[model samples]
Target: MDIFEFYKKMDADDIMLSFKGSVTSELLTSVLQIIEAKMERLNEPSKIKKKVYNVLVESLQNLYHHMDKNEQDIKGHSTVIFMIGNNAKAYSIYTGNYVRNENAEKLQAKLEKINSLNPDELKAYYKEVLNNGMMSDKGGGGLGMIDIARKSGQKLNFRFQQVDNEFSFYSLNINIAKQ
Candidate 1:
C-alpha cells in the first residue's frame, strides 16, 4: 500500500478520523467521545455538532448491530471501515462493512425508499413506524436510516458490491451541511 498516497488523500479530504477493524461497543464509545471532543474544540456551532454526532452514532450502531452474522468467515480481523471528514461546506461520514449477500437487495430497497422521501414524508414515515411498533430482533424500529436522513438534511449515499456468492460489501455515506 502507498502510505503517502493514503495520507495525501486524507489530507485533501480533511479527514478527522478513520478506522478499519471489527466494530464493537467499546470502540464505538471511544470513537464517539473522540469525535465529540474534537468537534467541541473546533468550536463548531452546537446545531452542526449535534447533527454530526447523531449521524455518527446511528452509523456506528447500525454496523455494530446489523453487520453480517458470519463476520469470521475467512475475512480475517477486519470487518468494517469508517471515516469522517469535513470540507468547507459540510462534514462527511462514510462506513463500509460486510453483509450477507441475501440481504443486499432488501437493504438497497429500503435505502432507496428512504432516499426518495422529502423531509415531511420522512417525518410521517418515522411516526408510522413508531406507531406500528415493529422492530427487528436487533430492536431497531427501522428508524435509524430515517433519523440519519432527517438529521443530516441530505440523502444517504450507498452502494453494494458482491464479495462472493455468500457475502457482499455495503457502504454508506452521509453528509451534514455547515450552513
Candidate 2:
C-alpha cells in the first residue's frame, strides 16, 4: 500500500476523519470526541459544529444498532466504513455497512419516501411517526432518518450495492452547511 497516495487522496477529498471497523458504543464515543476536537481546533462556527455533531450521532447510532447481523455473509467479516469531510461550503458525513439483501428493498423504499417530502412535510411526517409510537426492536421509532433530514435541511443521499446473494452494502451521505 502507498501511504503517501492514501494521504494525498484524503487531502484531495477533504476527508477530515475516516474509519473502517466493527461498530460499537465505545468506538462511537471515541469518534465523537475526535471529531469534536478537530472541529474545535479548526474554530468551526457553533451552528455548523452542532449540526455536524448531531447528524454524526444519529448516523453512528444507526450503524451500531442496526448494521447487518454480526455473522456477516461476506467471509464472516463485519465492519462499517465512516468518514467526515470538510470543504468550503459544507461538512459531509458518509457511512457504509453491510446489510442483509432481504432488507435492502425496504430500506431503499423508506429512504426514497423520506427524500420525496418537502421541509414542512418532513416535519409533519416526523411528528406523525413520533406520535404513532411504533418502534423497532432496536428502539428506533423510525425517527432518526427524518430527524437527520429535518435537522440538516437536505435530502439524504443513499445507495445500495449488492455484495452477494445474501448481503448488500448500504451507504449514506449527509451534509451540513457551514453557514
Candidate 3:
C-alpha cells in the first residue's frame, strides 16, 4: 500500500509514527521521545507504557542489527519501517524490513511456530530457549516474539509482501489491550 493510504488506515484515536531509511541510534532516540510524548498526551497507564516501551526497544534493535549485518546504506535506503498506534481498545506496534526470499521463508516458519502456541506453551518455549542460551548476539533468538506475545496478551500479527522474486517485505505487528 502507498504511504498515505497506510497512514489513513491507522486508528484515529491513536498516535502514529513511521520511520523509513536507515535505523540509527539518534533516529531511534528521537522516535522514542515522540512516542513518550504521545503516550503522555493519551494518559496511558504506567503498565501499558512499560510494555510498549519494551516492545519498541526490542523491535528497533532487531532492525538496527539486521541492517548493520547487511551493510545497508542510509541514504535513500528502504530498509526498515517502524509504526506504532492504538485504537480505543488496544495499542499496536509494527516493524517491517526487506529480507531475502530465503530469510523471509525462514522467518515465516518461525512466526508460524510462535503463532501456533497458546500463552502457557509460548512461555514455556521462551523459557526453554532462554535456558538453553540460544539467543543470538543481536540480543534475541526467538524470545522477542514470545515476549511481544506475552506482554501484549495477544497473538502475533504479521504479513509478507513480495517485492520481487528475490526479496520480500516482512511486516510484524503486536497488539496490546488498553484495559
Candidate 4:
C-alpha cells in the first residue's frame, strides 16, 4: 500500500496500546503486560495468545539489540515504537526503529530472502541457517525473520525511512489471523 493508505489504516485501527522509548528490559516487561491485558480483554483463546506473545517477545528483543543508536552522544538510546491492532481479518503488530544505513541494505536483503520463500522453503532455509550460520552474542543465529514469518503465517512487510546520511528508520509489520 502507499504510505498515505498505510497511515490512514493505522489511524483508523483501534490501537490497544502504543509505546515509544528506549527498549530496555523494564520497558519490554511493561509493554508485554499491556499487550497481555489487551489480549485478555479481547477474550483471545490461549492458542492465539501464545502465538502473539511469542511474536511480540521476539520482535521486541530484536529491536532492543539490533536497532541503531546515535553515536555522537554516549547516552543516546535507540528509538523504538510498538503498536498492536486488529482488523476484520487479522491482528497486526508493528515495530519501528533506527538502523544504520549500512545495516539497512543487509536487512533488506535478508527480509527479501525470507519473503521469497514458501512455507516449506522457509522451513528448509531456516534449518540450513540454524545449522550453519554463526550465532550472534544474543544467539539469534539469523532466525528472527524466519521465526516471525513462520509464526505470523504471513509475509513480513517492511520499509526504510531516511533519517539522515548515516541511518534510516526501519519499520516492520507482522499480521496474525483472528482464527
Candidate 5:
C-alpha cells in the first residue's frame, strides 16, 4: 500500500484511528483503549465518547465473531478493515470484511429492516429480539445492528460487492453526531 497516500487521506479526513488486518480479542481491547485515550485527549464530551465506545465494542466484536470465519489462514488471519474519524458534524466509524455470498442477502435484508425503523420502533424491536432469546452461532440475536442504529441515530450505510461465487465484501459506515 502507498503509505504516504494513505496518511494524507487519513489526515484529510480527520481520522483518529485505523486498522486493517485480523481482529483478535487482545488487539480489539488495545484498539478500544487507544481510541478512548485519543478521544479524551481531544476533549470529546463524555457522553459522545461513551456512545462511540459502546458502539465500537459491538462493531468490533461483530467483526471478530460473524465475519468469514473460514477464510482464516494457518496463522489465524482474515482480512478486515476498520476506521474511526471525526469532522465538524460527527464521528464516523467504518468496517469492512468479507462474508459468504450465502450470508450476504440475509445481512442486507436485516440492515434494511433496521434502517427502516424509527427510534421508538427500533427500541421496541430491540426489546423483542432480546426477549426472544434467539441467537445465531455467533451469539448475536441481531441486536448489534439495531444497537448501532439506535446509538448512531443514523441509517447504516452498507454495501456488498461480489468477490466470487462464494464470497462478497461487506462494508458498513456509521456516523454519530456531536450533538
Candidate 6:
C-alpha cells in the first residue's frame, strides 16, 4: 500500500478516526472517550455531540454484538472496519463486517425498509418492533438500524458485497447533520 497516497485520501475524505480490528468492550470505551475529547476540543455544540455519540454507540454496539466470528475465508474472520468522518454537511460513521451468507438478504431487506420510512413511520415502526419482541439471528431484528435512522434523521446507507460462498461483507454508512 502507498502510505502517502492513503494519507492523502483520508485527508481528502475528512476522516477523523478509522480502525480495522476486532471489536471489544475496552476498545469501544476508548473510542467513545476519544470522540468525546475530540468533540470538546473542536467545541462542537451539545446537541450535535449528543446525537453523534448516541448513533456511534448504536453503530459500534451492533458491530460488536453481531460479528460472525466463525465466518469462513479470512483468518481473522472477526475483524471489522470502522471510520468517522467530518465534513461541512455532516459527521459520518461507517462500519463493515462479515455476515453469514444466509443472513445477508434478510439484513438488506430490513435496512431498505428502515430507509423507506419517514420520521413518524420510523417512530411507529420502532415501537411496533419493540412490542413484537422478535430477536434476529444476531439479535434485535433490525432494531439497531431503526434506532440509527431515527437518531440520525437520515436514511441508512448500506451494501453487501459477496466475499465467498459462505460469507458476505456488510457495510453501513450513517451521517448526522452538523446543523
Question: Tens digit of lDDT per residue, candidate 3, span 1-179?
Answer: 49787666664535577667788889889888888888889899999888888888777887888787676533233568877877777777888888878888998888889889998998898899889857676667767777877777777789988878877888887877788
- Whose TM-score is higher: candidate 2's or candidate 3's? 2
TM-score of 2: 0.92
Q: Candidate 1, overall lDDT?
A: 0.87
Model 1 error, position 59 (Å): 0.4
* Model 6, residue 106: C-alpha shift (Å): 0.6
Model 1 Cα lDDT, one tens digit per residue, 108-154: 99999999999999999989987896887774678899899999988
Which residue pairs collide, candidate 3?
Answer: none
Task: Report the lDDT tens digits of candidate 5 across residue range 15-132.
Answer: 9889898778899999999989988998999999999998999999988875445555222326789999889888899999887787899999999999899999999999999889
lDDT of 4 by residue, 37-69 (tens): 878998888888888998888888887775433
**lDDT score for residue 68 of model 6:** 47
Return whichever of 2 and 4 wins on TM-score. Answer: 2
Model 3 stretches astray by more than 4 angstroms: 1-15, 72-78
**Candidate 4 lDDT (Cα, whole model)?**
0.82
Of candidates 6 and 3, the better by lDDT? 6
**Model 6, stretches more than 4 Å misplaced?**
68-75, 135-141
| Lowest summed lDDT window (length 10), candidate 6 | 67-76
lDDT of each: 0.87, 0.88, 0.79, 0.82, 0.87, 0.89
Error of 6 at 70 (Å): 4.9
Predicted candidate 3, C-alpha RMSD:
3.1
lDDT of 2 by residue, 1-179 (tens): 99999999999989988999878888899999999998999899888889999999999998887654354444544778999999999999999988878888999999999999999999899989998968877746779999999999999999999988888999999999887
Clashes of each: 0, 0, 0, 0, 0, 0
Which ten-residue region of model 4 has the weakest summed lDDT? 68-77
Candidate 4 residue-pair clash tally: 0
Pairs clashing within candidate 2: none
